[model samples]
Target: MEMIEMNTRERRRMTLMTRVAEGLLKLRMAAEMLVVSYRQAKRIWRRYREEGDVGLVRRGRGRSSNRTRPAAERKRAVALYVKQYGGFGPLLASEHLASDHGIKVDHETLRRWLLSAGLWASRRRREAHRAARERRPRRGDLVQIDGSEHDWFEGRGPRVVLMVMIDDATNKTLARFYEGEDTAAAYDIFDRYVCQEGLPVALYPDRDSIYVCTREACLEEELANVGPETQFARAMRELGVGLILAHSPQAKGRVERRHGLFQDRLVKEMRLLGIRTLVAANAYLDGTFLALVNARYTVKARDPTNGHQTRPTTATLALVLSWQEPRTVAKDWTLCWRNHRLQIDARHAALGLPGRRVVVAERRNGTLAILHNKRLLTFRNAPAPAAPRLRPAAPQAPHLTRRPPAADHPWRRSALIHRPVFCPPPTSYTAHSRGAENRAAATPSRAVPTT
Candidate 1:
């Protein structure tokens, strides 16, 4: 006989039926014990007598579920997910499934299916309360900016830094991959953002040295011109854009969150397209990826008014956004840059440029400009000396002949070898020989030889 598995409730009813069959318990009493009606108890008791404990087992036990999906359909979905949407989260994959393949599945159901099939792992989300930050009123009212340094190519190419700016109100994002996150790169990023969306009302960024100068000397200098500002900050000041420095990264959480999203989805997308270089990646972003991301993620602003104002002309923008440094021209009418001397033209003699300080402007497109009092100067490039000239090679040393020693000199004296005054005593052999000689002398010349 096949054994039947029964739950606690079923076993209890079977136990009560056994007592009823033994004639110890009445039918009404068994019904009361099992919490069932008297008629139902009578039927259960009869079935127990005929079929034993098996009759208490549920009839639907060990049977397939009525709402189960077909094996073929499940296998098809799992195969598609593993092949194409492996990195996608469950809800995103479910959306793609319905949109692309007519597979109408609930997100939780698909998540469970993926989990059971070993295609997806569940992530436990942290539940910590943060300070609430309301979005701005207009699209360009406030922009949050940050740089994410990542190995975006996953070893397919060199690692790079991605400069990202997101509108706090509309969630609009502008990003470009760069070699580093420095003042020059930040200036280029702002230049691009301004050309497209005009000047924002304010920019929110971290207190990086590229964005703000924290040095004591720099703070002192800020007393004169822009206060405690870096080169990038000065450019923004010239553009009439306000900046808000975040004390903590969470203060500008919008761009930080977008960085996480890009590191995940953008990396995979670039991998699929074999985009390794920064140029190709940026082009892909401008042409296709940006539109896709904005459409999927952006939201309407609270206020309908556009906060971005009109930008300045291209020439002014270039001048304001460039890297400028003040240098004093040397006696040779040259200024040094990157170890190369920029020689001002002789024609500038009319301007009397020697020993005068001029501002050197380094443009983003790899061009150099020298300006004195806001007037452009013509200059040529030459290799600058690595070190200052030394004294003359020291004066040549005078040579002299050596003099020979005379006969009366100390070298003509007789040399002496000093010896120890006292000799060391000999061992047992020498003492014994002396004693033998004394004994022989005491014995007198017993054997005097004629020779």
Candidate 2:
């Protein structure tokens, strides 16, 4: 007797065939129970009767799938991945394999191979329960912007921040590398996005101080019924673009999720290409990486109409997307900013700039412009005021000489032991009596009785 292995389905079919052969069930009834055609059931019954239990098993059960790649091909893919694409996720690795190495393999298949080869570890995902939010209806309706600071160069260079802007509706992404996440980075990335894709209807960003003013309102601002606005916020308002602040990281889940993806995929891609500087990283981002990401991840918006307005002119954009502050011109036609005095051109002094408010705009290129009545004014760096000169000390009066007393002078003797006493003559008898009593009081032991 030989042992046979069969799945539950196969065992059930075998029992059913035995009953049909014993006349306990009819072929038609068996066919109905098995949910198969009468002809197929007849074939199964015939095979079972002629070949016993062995014939009841499926024919292709233990054989390799016809679509499975050869062992040599699988080995090559795994080797290539370990050598060149290590640390890449299966999906990204498969994409590179197909595009770069001319190896076509499904990501799922590659994932299994990597797991079996111990090149990848399975990750347990803990997805929090949150209500799903639908994407916007048209492209450029809402864009999500955020910065991700990471070791983007993998210790080869200084760590930098990648400022990412992703469209809420289509998932189109724009990104650039900066030294830090600041107003300057925000302006640069937004300026590029607007120029390339036009002005979006609104921007969705986390409540970072770069995007929202976190400072408390001052008394003056409160009394004016106004609140402080960040430079980025002010620029957006001037461009007629709405600014929506996400209360939590989850509120802008799309961009947050994008950060995770880029941290994984973009980091690896940059490492492979040896991108270790901001300029090279940004060049690659603009030229290649962004296009690839958009092509792979972007989807058609529900509505075909573009929600973006036309982009502003270059000069207009530069003026709007700058750090602007209102400064009052002094009597000397000079403006003080950041401890530097900017002397207004004498030509513009004819415009009566004294005691008037003008906007001082610090442009992205580190240039400063003074704007009055929407017109640019020429200015130069005023020389710092000369240090005060020290005055000479006043002449001192001549010192006075002093004379010393003789050693035996009366001033050196004690008055209690060496002083003389004098008595005044009385003017009347009653006065004489008072004086005598006074003398008596002064010399208690010599008191005289008055009768």
Candidate 3:
């Protein structure tokens, strides 16, 4: 007897057919149990009775699928992948194979082939558990923004930072490449986003110093009893958009995950396109890559309503999104900014521009302007102050001549040789005693003390 392989369903059917053959269960009941049509059950019963348990096994077993690719095609795909697309994930490699090589293989099918060929290893990551947060209900309600510093060019060019903004509701994204993650990059990307999609109601950003002022309050700010604010924050406030700072990268995980995806797909895409510079990368990003990403990733929001405000005018945007600081005009109608003296135009001199505060704005285009009460003021670069001249040193005084003292001068005489001499009488014992008595009699004694 030949051993036949049968799955659980076949074995179960065989048991049911055995019972039906014994008249223990009706064929109709067996058909109901197997959830098959009565006609199909009858055919199965007839076949089982005629050919035994072996016939219950599926005939298609041990036969290749009709949908399977030809051996030559499989070998060719594997060869192409090994030669040119090594290290690419199965899905990405399959896409490239389809688009570039005309090999139409499903990513899942290609994954199995790669695994079997030992070209790709399966990765099973144990992800940390996180509570899922529901997305905002409307598009433009909250946009998550982040900067990913990456070797985006795969050693073909310098490493760059990719600034990305993604909608929390729809996953719609906008991105740009910059040399570094700085205030200027943030401003530029944000400006483009606002200009294109209008202003989102709220922005979600990490607690980077570019998005939030992480510095301790300065003396002036402390005296004013206010917290420090970054230029980005100030711009958002001026535009009436809320700035929500995420305490952790996970808080804005939408954009963070987008960064990961870009680092994978965008890097490979650029590498394939031979994009080796920031300018070319950004051009490809805006022109083609962004559209592809948004089309694939964006989904319909719960609410179809748009939460973005109307886009502001170009002038308004330039003014609001600029680096602005207050400068006090001096008595000469001049203000010092970044160590350059800016003289207020003479036409404005009659307006008493001196001793007034004006905003010195450095726009994104590297142009400077002075605005007083939201009006642009004309100004010119003041000439540098002239260096002071040093006075000549005073004429030197004439040299003095010294005279030597005379040899016979008083200053040169010895004191011992010029002194006068004195003589005294010689003392005797009898004369000494009489002199002492005479001196005692002549001096009155103080006898009142005894009395």
lDDT of each: 0.85, 0.90, 0.90
User: Whole-model lDDT, candidate 1?
Assistant: 0.85
- TM-score per model over all chains: 0.68, 0.81, 0.80
Model 3 compared with the native: what TM-score?
0.80
Model 2 TM-score, all chains together: 0.81
Flag regions of model 3 displaced more than 4 Å. 1-4, 222-226, 345-357, 372-375, 389-451
Instruction: In model 3, state the lDDT of residue 271.
Output: 73
Error of 3 at 70 (Å): 0.8
Candidate 3, clashing residue pairs? none
In every candidate, how many clashes are there?
A: 0, 0, 0
Which structure among the candidates has the greatest TM-score?
A: 2
Which residues of candidate 2, in runs, are more than 4 Å off? 1-3, 344-356, 372-390, 396-451
Measured on C-alpha atoms, candidate 3 has an lDDT of: 0.90
Model 1 quality (TM-score)? 0.68
Better of 1 and 3 by TM-score: 3
Mind giving the per-residue lDDT tens digits that candidate 1 earns over 1-451?
A: 6767789999888788888888989999888888889898878877888888988777788898898778888788788888878888777777778987888788888888898988888878896678889999998889998999999998998888999999999999999999999887788888889888888989999989888887655643556565556788878887888889999877888898999889988887787689999899999999998999899999999899999978799987888788888898998898897777888999889888777789898877878899888888888886656797677777777887789877776665532234336877987999899899999888856666796
